[model samples]
Target: MPLEIVMSVSFARAGLILGLGLTVASGACAPLRSHQGYIIDADLVNSVQPGVDNRQSVAQVLGRPTIASQFGAEDWYYVARDSRNLNFQKPKPKEQITLKISFDPSGTVKSVTRTGVEQIAKVDTFGKTTPTLGKKRGFFEDLFGNIGTVGAAGAGGPGGGGGGGRDTP
Candidate 1:
């Protein structure tokens, strides 16, 4: 290769490598994030015995639950998720924990359970259509459907409308 051509090729290669390095470095420098709901420690959760812990004792140990059942069953839930996102892309879920504690009517912990991300359920809609009861018309039919119906209901004026005081012959 000619010296001039070789030198230009080396410069181009160097620029490409530098650009790649900067891209990789920028990603590596991004802060790893753990956006969680309720960050409860495993040891603390174990401290509360299922049969022994009452509402107050559990509250004291685990603090208030992230959410309590609003309807029928009395269940306290502590859920947390760890995710990391690059720039503004969708965050990737690294880990998830869900602890559900059921309480008896007497307000004592009845059962304690721990769950992982595997329990997550992905729901999907069935179809992209809705069934309705109505006549389906074509685009052109709907556009010109009312064109000749405007004054058909009454003479250009209101039906039965009184005319001038002088009666027409």
Candidate 2:
């Protein structure tokens, strides 16, 4: 091949490799989407009327609830979350819907309430080790701290007891 053609081919190959690498890198950076918990159907959810729908009818329309209230008044919660994450990062909620169906004593739906991502609470964790109130002990101290303290005076050792409430005769 001619010198000019050879150089041209080399440049073409380099361009092709660079393009492929960029495509793969861009794909890696793409956000991964995930849906968790109850899959909401708008029509079905809307069809369930407060007084008209009871526990059985609600279940038939929306299926099982994500969680039911264990304490207080009876409430069924249908939770749905759409989250996205990049690479190996923790998934963050893009959108969240919580459908709360409050029930009366007769099992009839008292109210149907919908809440969005605004209700989500972000809690900032301090550190890996939880803050505690105590004397900070080292590894060796925790391992062998009770060495001499086990049979020490006033610690219910063999010599710690008085002579069984009797006088020596």
Candidate 3:
């Protein structure tokens, strides 16, 4: 082969190698983003009232709660939440709120109890959002884009071309 032709071939090979390396490296370091929210404390809700607290008066004071009793209208529940996140990644929950109030047969306040008003560090898996700009690329996009067409196309084998088939000589 001519010396110039050989040198050009070597440069092209180097470029292909560099491109493949970069593609793989980028895949390994994909930027991560997430968001999460939760209610940090239920006591803050005490700004209203509890325990034998006046039901009608409390409702007027705290406004309507987020939840109510499933079987009857005698019980009411108030809920609070906090959320945080970065971007593509899922959000994390920082706090939660659960208020339970029971009323007597005459619709008077009987008892009030609360639960799940504790700080937590649980991942908010449901906060996933699909990106709008581009279709989500997977491992293949980076792998194929970086590898040279010749090498990548033939990676499957002699007869496989771009697929994973046995390359029979």
Candidate 4:
């Protein structure tokens, strides 16, 4: 091969490798996704006093809550989670913020509470077997269930079989 051609080929291979490495590295570092809810500034959250701020005023300053209380409509919850998910891997939450705002019967802000990642709850499943509906049977029963249904499928009833084989005669 010509020296010039060999040098150009080497440079092309190096460039290709650099480009592929960059692509794979970029994919491995998935962009951080922020699941934001009720985007209100921290200063605004503090500005709305419990005793002084009313529902309308608080709504104007801070947006609506991400979710309301399950049992009642007075409690408002503002939550946000920052997570990174690469490919098919489960999303790992890097940061989480939850703001709970309570309202009195008069529709005025009563209190504001905030919680961070410390509140994350770890849930453990009971066992490896997923819940399925059916009665548990032995291995023999499972193996014989289909095998025992053979005579019932042909043109024969219980204890009534027609054998054309010469051995049966």
Q: Superposing all C-alpha atoms, what RMSD in Å does each candidate have to the true structure?
A: 6.9, 5.5, 22.2, 8.0
| TM-scores for all predictions | 0.60, 0.77, 0.40, 0.66
Tens-digit lDDT track of model 4 for 26-61: 977876565655555789888989889888997788
What residue runs in model 3 are displaced by over 4 Å at the alpha carbon?
Answer: 1-52, 117-169
Report how far off residue 103 is in candidate 4 (Å): 0.8
> What's model 1's lDDT at 128?
92
Ranking by lDDT: 2, 1, 4, 3
**Local distance difference test, candidate 4:** 0.80
Residue 1 lDDT in candidate 3: 92
lDDT of 4 at 80: 84
lDDT of 2 at 35: 96
Report lDDT (Cα) of residue 138, candidate 3.
81
Candidate with best TM-score: 2
lDDT of 2 at 23: 100
The better candidate by TM-score, 3 or 4, is 4
Model 2 misplacement above 4 A: 1-16, 143-146, 149-169
After superposition, candidate 1 runs with Cα above 4 Å error: 1-25, 28-32, 124-169
Give per-residue lDDT, candidate 4, residue 70: 71
Q: Order the numbered candidates by TM-score, best leading.
A: 2, 4, 1, 3
* Colliding residue pairs in candidate 1: none
